[model samples]
Target chain A: MTHGISMAGYMFVNPGEEILVPSLFWGNYNLSFINAYDAKIKPYNLFKGEGLDVAAMGAELMSEGDKKILLLNFPNNPTGYSPDVREMKEIISAVEQAAKAGKKIVVICDDAYFGLVFEEGIEAQSPFAWLANLHENVLAVKVDGPTKEDYVWGFRVGFMTYGIKGGTEALYTALENKTAGAIRGSISNTSNLSQSLLLEAFDSPTYQEEKKEKFNILKSRYEAVKQAMKNPDYAEFFKAKPYNSGYFMCIELKDGLDADVVRRLLIEKYSIGTISLNNLLRIAFSAVAVKDILALFDGIYSACKELTV
Target chain B: MTHGISMAGYMFVNPGEEILVPSLFWGNYNLSFINAYDAKIKPYNLFKGEGLDVAAMGAELMSEGDKKILLLNFPNNPTGYSPDVREMKEIISAVEQAAKAGKKIVVICDDAYFGLVFEEGIEAQSPFAWLANLHENVLAVKVDGPTKEDYVWGFRVGFMTYGIKGGTEALYTALENKTAGAIRGSISNTSNLSQSLLLEAFDSPTYQEEKKEKFNILKSRYEAVKQAMKNPDYAEFFKAKPYNSGYFMCIELKDGLDADVVRRLLIEKYSIGTISLNNLLRIAFSAVAVKDILALFDGIYSACKELTV
Candidate 1:
């Protein structure tokens, strides 16, 4: 909440400035900016083939007068999509053009599900490391938390870093003071005990090794989910999007079926709850067991067969 | 911060409504109500004889019109002074009359330093238990936190309970829903880890025993401070107010001696820091060692002697 508020405060984009957002975006992005910051969010429909709709993003940026900020999310929420190197370069070029055009483009990468790319082709990179030293006009604000990565949902421990010109020390000091002021004015400070616990965990010798093991287990489970979706009965109900990392996968419902109807039937009749986004349903593969994935799909398939339009 | 915002949000008394405040009030109250709520703060000046000016409080209540909220703090900050039974009764009477006048009076008892009353005559009680059930109009809102009580400053863990006409269940449910909504709108929720840790601490058998021992230690330290303040060199410098609980005490400086001047000298020359409120210099006994109490006063006394006035 603190980080979100801080980022929203710094977003000084002018009226009608086109900020590119993927069609498959987190609901909170709209809530945080359009609803909260009162900035315009121009949605670029995602490219059918890979990661982000880079070509569409570039065209949108060129079409709009001047881009002030480009919002990016990797290992994306609700879709579990990560842009490959080629697509990333195209996105970067569009951002560079915005920067060169004298529009102070603040790239806010909401890396909430960062470092969780699972698919064979998809690889993740910290945008902070990539764009921090790039240009004076191009500032990258990275918002990441322990909620997803460290499996500490209740902790609410997150940090925001600004990559700007001048040494890291100067940038950090200015950002820290502003951030601390925001914190003091809002919630005062994060839990002293939570910070202590996280510090302890980070300093622990086994943390990295244990985290890697957990990541591998999640990856295997995701693979199982992908393999199970290929089965005949479930395959006919929906088309599974290529998901490399993160907990969720987006499944496009069949033409005649309603995603919300399927979601309600699955929950009420089958005791399964999944999130429906328009014509798509997002299933969290991380929570369900590998052995149970097939059974869960079978149940969903059965419900769809009975309740389909 | 959450409690502060909630209090500010609901503290919308009509233009003529009187809100009683202590002379040595928390700074935030001024910001929250006077500046924000636009409510008038009628300060009941603390008497030099009695730690709390309860007689003045009662007189003010009897004289003023109805529709008032009496804000009380015990084991008070910047002056760890709790009122005796006589003073407590006067305050109770003041509240009772306000209730009888058909005024919806809220007795906001900030029990931040609760369970720390050390003196025999200056014991503390849960005002909610006493005054809340007295009249339907007399509502008691007890705002306390584990931050100070549990020695966890950074946790930002606080609880608020409403004493109302309904049974405990209904009151709790209403309070919970309102507070939870406030929390949701502000920071979404408190740190889950902090809540878990606090719950664990409360459930532990040895927690109370350990806390009692710490309380005794604080009590002893406060006693030492009282004895040191009685020293002849310091006694004449300022009027000593009775401090039985909490972390601090305020010394009423001589008529001509400026508190800021004294505070500055103490900090600059002696490397000691204390807060100043007009003519009063607040000394925090909790942060300093017991044995160092006399020495600290000695520094203050010498600083006072050096002043030409």
Candidate 2:
């Protein structure tokens, strides 16, 4: 599943070719693409004024060299921000614009934590649903897995689906063969037990009910975090990114304060661990219980107050 | 496990460098090393007069330009031959000799079948036990796992242990970090289920006894195949390679007869199947029952004669 994003970088993108990921991305993309394949990464601005920066992305897409690769992870990893239906449309249009400009775009949609939405009116579906089998110059590759969405974290089961148009049967077959061969060239095979367990679970009578129950539990935790953040006490510490989906949400440190000091102080003094990146602290709400959400935030707030002093 | 060989190629061996593998090798080594990494494969003849060609290997090790990687798999994949103690010593000496000649040789001992020795005189210990930390220039990397020896084929669990010399604590730590980083860059992680299952199995009451029982079953099958191959009725068809270990044994087609013809005829007419490679038919004794071994070979002999006519 991790290899889906990795294959796009290692197998599809040529060395030294620039892959335009967003400014805010899952850090492993760099390790997968740049460190693995020696490809360069160019970031498109993710957000402006608490909304997706579609215009900046469009400009970047049109301006970056043709025959480029774009990594689009919605309900994104760190920020947990999912684009609304209109935003999703605009994002696709940007890629289509590039394709219309005769630019070949291989869009890798990494839906790691798909369908974990906590808000209304924000469409939470795979870009695959629309982008696949849609265009000529745009090859939509959706990378997903049962690992997260299925709540089988230890299974490591993932999938890659290609929605490429403007190619004949032979061409498609060749492309699929290449994808399989790329997988073979990397990991020999996915573990069989995982695949079997997943298949059996899918066949089980309670699959949907179980999934919904799990989703509801996570939804409660997500809501708890949101309710706690509105307390006005954390406002002095950091402002969060516009987030309502996936496992995590990020808080941008206030007054340009660095997250490193705050992160270290929280771990050292308060024993509250969060992912520190740039000027933000990424809190994963998935594991935090509904009741513990506030206390977790309180510790972070205490750490910030101490660090600021 | 597959990437263990590849890591030696992609990480340890520089681009355009040469890797020395036996003429008879698990073919994926070529795919992983030469094709994937742009490294050249230098094959040393596996046999000289029905025994390991130590003289030829030593000569090649001496002549090949200083920086090289040697991939040693035993009990070998196709031939199932585990080198006797003397042969093992000769193999190590060749590397030590190269190191003494101011050459840096990274020996990747792919000990996939580490303990499955069929012959009495063959002490099939990993080369790491002897070669690791012994030389200044020779680095021994042993790759093995519970996948084969522990009777877990579907589980792709593997381990890679490095033994390098001329390194201080910091240097070694940095080297280990780089190796881990390489693994992280490739596959994000091996399946957590596999790791957990293996850990549980190790902690089980009868891990060693279970492994021993599995080993004994393979040993019986291996012996049966060996005894069956001794039938002079098959001599006209092919000459068996000196095999004493592992799952498979290969027979060289007499008079350079094409193995493809025999393989196809055996499948179509005799309803028997075998892996046809180069001029040899590789029979996997691991899966073939003790009583079925004779019939399997008889069918092959009948096919060979009919095809030859």
Q: What are the chain B TM-scores of all models?
A: 0.90, 0.96
Q: Please write out the lDDT profile of model 2 over residues B71-105, one tens digit for every residue.
A: 78888888898889998898888878888898887
Q: Give the per-residue lDDT digits (tens) of candidate 2, residues A1-309.
A: 567777776568777888888889888887888877778999989999888998987787788467878888888889999999899888877877788899888888989999898898897888877777667888888899887898998786778878877667887787788777766665677889888889999999999999999999999999998888897878887878999899999999897577988888888887788999899899999999998999988888888888778
Candidate 1 docking DockQ: 0.27
Among the numbered candidates, top TM-score falls to 2
Total residue pair clashes for candidate 1 = 5
Q: Quote the lDDT for B24 in model 2.
A: 92
Clashes of each: 5, 0
* Cα displacement (Å) at residue B99, model 1: 7.1
lDDT tens readout by residue for model 1, B252-289 = 88877889999999999998898889998888888888
My TM-score estimates for the predictions, one after another, are: 0.80, 0.97
* iRMS of each prediction: 4.2, 1.6
